[model samples]
Target chain A: MTDVTCFSADCNKSKLFWGLLALGGLVMLSTLSAYFYIEHHGHIVTGMNNQIVWGLPHVFAVFLIVAASGVLNVASIGSVFGKKIYKTRSPLSGLLALTILAGGLAVLVLDLGRSDRIIVAMTHYNFKSIFALNMIFYTGFFAIVGLYLLTLMDRKLKPWSHPVGFLAFLWRLALTTATGSIFGFLVARAGYNSALYAPMFIIYSFAYGLACFLVVQTAMYKWNNIQIDEYVLGRIKNLLAVFVAASLYFTAVLHLTNMYFAKQWDFERFILVEGDTYPMIFWLGQVIVGGIIPLLMIFSPGAAKSPARILIAALLVIVGGHAQMYVTIVGVQAFPLAIFPGYAETSSFFDGVVHPYSPSTLEVMLALGGMATTFLLTTVAVRILKFLPIDKLDQKH
Target chain B: MTASHKPERRDFLKTGAVVAGAAIAPGVLFYGIAQGRAPEEGASSLVRWGMLIDTGKCANGCTACVNACNTENGLSGKTGPQDSQWIRKLNIKHLQTGIEHNLPMLCQHCANPPCVDVCPTGASMKRADGIVLVDRHICIGCRYCMMACPYKARSFVHEPLADQNPDVPRGKGCVEACTFCVQRVDKDQQPACVEACNADGHQAMLFGDLRNPESAIAKAMLAYASVEVRGDLGLNTGVRYQGI
Candidate 1:
């Protein structure tokens, strides 16, 4: 085991830090521009309609939101699970979680019909609605994680870190559960309406959060020119593989269960084979490239020793997670709701037909803005705060 | 005695005129209220407004109800994928038997509305009188209501609205569905669709208070079996259909 120290001082001023901040700012500006354009011209100028209400923006928002919870797993491992290596990195983990959540929420709020009346959402309460419950859970995550971060960073309050960390861990799990249930509880759709989404989302969070952590950890180390111990990287890579496998397993179960029911035959066929882009995304984007390939790379012989291979796996997992969300959010809506059991129906509203959706330029910009928000905040946070752990590498692996 | 009789006759005529004026004034005022005034503030749960459509009476080529709803609700009736349609005429054909049917579909207005239950801000709500509506003041336009609705009854306002009926205010970015023309209902009149259908002589759509045992709709419901669309979900919808 290596002895670790904490860095309380501001990070050394570097061109790299300024460059990332500048890029983040540019993306955020474009996002704001898109928001204003949509706000002024209305959704009529965009591709979204009555049928496919939730579109590309939702996919990005949910991805960040789910990833935010998963990102905290590192801190949970450190504080709740009592791992020495993870414990030192708890502050950074907490910070990343908070920032990423903020980004996701920004996209969700801006995409609303009355973005100006956000206060109404804050004041109103429908206790039975899962969406309302999610509002509460989301706000609680920030407050709880904020406290956990303080407890970890403040030397005098360090003793309380364990308890605070435990609370944050439980809160995130609940938060992710609520997020998943947003789709699962949708009894109207054929694709969603299953309890499996809750656990599936949790497993997804694990994979996504670990992958994100690896990327950030690698970046910080490379920027500082510090030699990361091969042992540390190996542990994280192995854990990512396990999480990815678990996510794939849950997906299999969900499809298998759907296959068992004859009623789901049409929906399954649409998603698996007949759908326009949905089948391609499900098979190519989600299953093979995103899931199987990443798993193979992670479990390949001597793969853990190479940081590059692990990073590649992390990137693939992220891509796959996004594809999975696209299928879940957009593809589900694209498939028409089954109103009549045995009748072929037609109407002016594109009923009984697959609704086509392609992301607009504005939507893409808005989504990228959410990503930029996370990046900018994370950079500013790490530079000012004592987020990076001081690593003491051992020569012998 | 003759002079007294004359005065008495005159007095009787004046009293009769006064009584006639008093009786007619209320009817005129009610007509005015029906034309322009808003619904009274409180809607009671005692009155469950519902619709029962007799498919046997619905004509295949008739779109009078759809047109009436658009005009009443200030919708364009453009039939674009994104245009607001408070009501639509659906043509359904049985896959196995080759049997065909046509019906008008709108908000089921369930006793347990999924849209209301799923609305994040309580914007999609059912009034005490069982009229489901979106509280536009709070609807963040998330479109979750649209997703939750079994009937593709709801529409999201994609474009800024102009020339809207002052009583029916619509703006961009909010999800809206048929309000059962609560304005007309409050004034003790049938919905615009029902009126138009009756006017067109189709007489397929019947509107009345379901709770009142004596109501025409309730009586008709008793006479013939009515089925709620997707009734197996057990939402207990306020709207019902016959001869499906």
Candidate 2:
């Protein structure tokens, strides 16, 4: 590893930094404008109808919330497990977690039909609801992360940071589980009514969060001309391989479990084998390209040590994880359970019986805005604050 | 140092005790508040709003109930199957026996309602009288209740609504279902659909106080064996179908 001086003021001088901030700000304004317009007029502005009550915004919101959990992995590794390699990067990881949380919240607010009544969600708590529990966990997690970051800034408060870090790790795990239970506890809806969703989310959080963190870290290192140790990068590649394998296994088990039960076979087959939109996403996008291809790239001896090849695998894992979330949440609802079987099965796809949905252009723009917000916040923190410890490399074990 | 440290240790213990007490205080206060407001105990005064659907007499093709509900509730034009089905006519056939039955289905208003159980915001709740209504003002549009409902009775207002009946107070980001015409019931009038059913001379749909023995639904329940959908779940649903 080559030693590089802290770019005292150069962090603020990057062209990408300014560009991302401007783009992020513009996106936020546009999303806010759309939200207010819809609020005043009603939900008629969106494409969602009765059968497909949840559409693109719901999918994106859940995706962002899940991704937010993943963004905390590096911090958990460094602070909770006391990993030396990750120590310098802990604050950056915290910043990522915070930014992702904000993005997640924004997507949720925008998805609501009454955006102004969001406060009602807080005031009215249904103790029986896993979704309500998740809201509470989300709030607590944010508060804890804020406190942890503040504690890190004061050298005198360092001794107390470990407990805070431990709590953050435990809280994040709980938060992710709660998010999973939001869907898992739905016993009525065939696609989502399962216990598997909870643990599956936690596993993907580790895989996706680590991949996202590495992408940003690698990009930053390149921009600053900082050299990363071959040993560290090698370890990360190995970790990525394990995460990708686990994620693939979780997904396979979910499908297999549903198939094993003959009664559930109709809905399972409809979504996995027969459905038009679902089969392509489940097989090509999520399973083969997202899972098998990435698994091969990471585990194959020929490609294992190559940094550039490993990054591609990581990217695939992120894309696959995201696609999985969409299919799991949105695709399952596409197949309508007919209350009456004797009547001719109404072809909902052709007839307007089923609501047709594809994200409107503005919905896509809002989702991109969420990602840009994450990037811009992280960039500003790295530039203006001592988020990454510049002196950690020089310290002896 | 020992003498001074003794007072410091006592002070530390006191501080620790106070902090622990503070943490536990909120839980205790919440419990007390819940208990204090507990309703007067007697034979349950809660109105148990229920419906009795006579499948034997239901005219399969006559969509009078659907139209009547749409007109009375001020719902927009019927767009999709799932959006607005306060009363849906279904042709059910048992796969094993090939038994066919034409049934009109709506919110069953279960005593142990799954929708109410899963609502994160308590927006979906059974009134003391057993009518399951969603408080639209409080819903965050999370849609957990929609997934929990066994009959798929709930619908989400995904797009903004216009031309809403000012009395109804519809909003987006909330789950809604048939309230058995709660406003009409409160006014001591029959549900609009029920009125429409009677006016069409079908007499297939019946509404009454389940608690009153002389009511038509109660008399019908006694005369004929009434059936509830998915009765195995034991939700004690208010809506019962006769001769299904």
Candidate 3:
């Protein structure tokens, strides 16, 4: 067995590391304070109105959950396909999955209007509800991933690790798909009522998951003073490039199909081009900054190999993926379904229609706190538990 | 690894037998409970609560139903356009013909409610006597029921509640809709809104058991063709409208 030592002793001088860690801690404290405030005052503190009941918290939760699903892909490749390149990294990847899952769950729990009675949602199962099914799937997926990570850590249980990994991969996919279907199955809401949402989420999981993995892995390498092999880095960059392009294609297809079908043109146009905040985020932030820019950087021969460019690209992709989620979930609820035509016609666009949705200061703090918790937990796991294997993969191959 | 080598089949059978027994126990217990609680044969005391709204006879200007509901329920007048409405006046129009109709709407209390079908937690359920109510105490506030409700009757108490009626159940983190004034119903009294309409001499709202042939609701159903909104959803709603 190769001996490993703390890389932090020598390579912990990066300002970005300290800045990110402190920022994360600040976010966490603020979120916790906001949660207590909501508990004291009520959900009224947030901007959720009757028409736009779900707000930024739900958007954050879905983004984190989907990203978590994507984070498991490294382990899936290592354990299921026996990929030597990823095997050494599997333990760290598994830990990342668990950490991200916890962060996602925290966001969801805090978003509930009645956070106190969350257990009733579990103890009393609504058999017919897809949302109920999602709850079960999430619980089961977390357990499976957590147990598999444990098995990886214990050498005695290594024999069963492969089977567990395979199961986790399949289970996580199903969980992500189910989450997507929650919106897809809603026939009433113009923005959500679509069959394409499920596949779109699966594609998103891969793109965003790869982006998260690259960002964290690069930071870990630098912090530990370990040189990531140029060959391995190149392969990962290629993979990321492919994923970004695929994501962009899927997004384009979604909008093109929506435009072509014309069933929901009014709502779709408003959201895509005319809606407040959505159009800017979707077209510029998500597509241009999050999608096209990242794709261009990763695919360009001159920039693809540059570590700085790669990191920037990964950051953009992550930002874009989250932007996509916000637009899909939050933007959909912004416009009310004109149920009463006579009243709707008589009244102004805002009258009898709720235009209430602004993420409270506390809501933003809590969301930022959730992100910080994920990073802090991951950092601690890497440092204290030796979750990342130092030299498991030899260059001899 | 060594344990796998010894008596594999015998151990498997033993474990299988135990598992099989555990699986069947719940079914057997449920059957026994059902038999023990079975009502007397040919004895019918079941109440099928329903509502009959006469839109044709109803005076549109009088907000008596709304006022009565607010006063009786001690509503704090905090309800905005975004808030829950136990009873709402909808001004609907035909998509093609542009024919407009003003009608009051509430919980349909469907026999096969989509809200009930989609509630992952049994919080949204129809009572044995046919009243659709939310058990706020057990509700998880996932709001799946809200999305499923065709009438958009359900509302989430998004903030800490204040000035709620003590006798009438209310809270946050739960979906709420019209209870058909279950508190009054238990006392054999009509819903506050229905009573108010009657007192006003408009008598546009009638509350009774649709199953009872002698009930006014049943007679109204026989005399006039009552309509339920989005009946194509096949919910078999308790709330019916006349001249809709």
* Top of the candidates by TM-score: 1
- DockQ for model 3 equals 0.24
Q: lDDT tens digits, residues B136-233, model 3?
A: 77777767676666666777776566777887767766778888887778667899889988899988899999999999899989999988766655
| Clashes by residue pair, model 3 | A27-A369, A114-B173, A126-B120
Docking band of candidate 2: acceptable
Ranking by TM-score: 1, 2, 3
Q: What would the TM-scores of all predictions be? A: 0.92, 0.85, 0.84
DockQ each candidate and list the results. 0.69, 0.24, 0.24
Query: What digit string (tens of lDDT, one per residue) describes model 2 on residues A219-320?
Result: 777667666665566667778778778988898898899889875787788778887587788888788777889878877775544667777887887788
* Candidate 2 lDDT by residue in tens digits, B1-244: 8997999899999999999999999999999766643445312334566788888788767777877877787766464643555556666656667766666667898989988888877878888778889987677776667667777676776555678877677765566778888777766789988999999999888997888787878888999998877676677899998886
lDDT of 3 by residue, A1-397 (tens): 9864547653444445566668778778788898888777766677766656677777777787888888888888789988777777788888888788788888888877677877776787876777889889888987999889888889899998999999999998898888888888776666776778888888888888878888898887776767766667776788888777888888888788778866568777878888888889899878998888988888788663577788899999989987888788778777555444323322211323535578878778767655777888887677667764454447314
What stretches of model 2 exceed 4 Å from their correct place? A1-12, A301-305, A338-356, A389-397, B1-46, B81-83, B95-99, B158-167, B172-174
Over B40-127, each residue of candidate 1 has an lDDT whose tens digit, in order, gives 6578888899999998898997999999999999999898877888898888888999888889989999999999999989999899
TM-score of the second chain for every model? 0.84, 0.78, 0.78
Evaluated on CA atoms against the true complex, candidate 1 attains a DockQ of: 0.69
> What is every candidate's alpha-carbon RMSD to the true fold?
6.7, 15.1, 14.2
Once fitted onto the true fold, the runs of candidate 1 whose alpha carbons sit more than 4 angstroms away are A1-13, A392-397, B1-41
Going through the candidates in the order shown, the clash numbers are 1, 6, 3
- Candidate that scores best on lDDT: 1
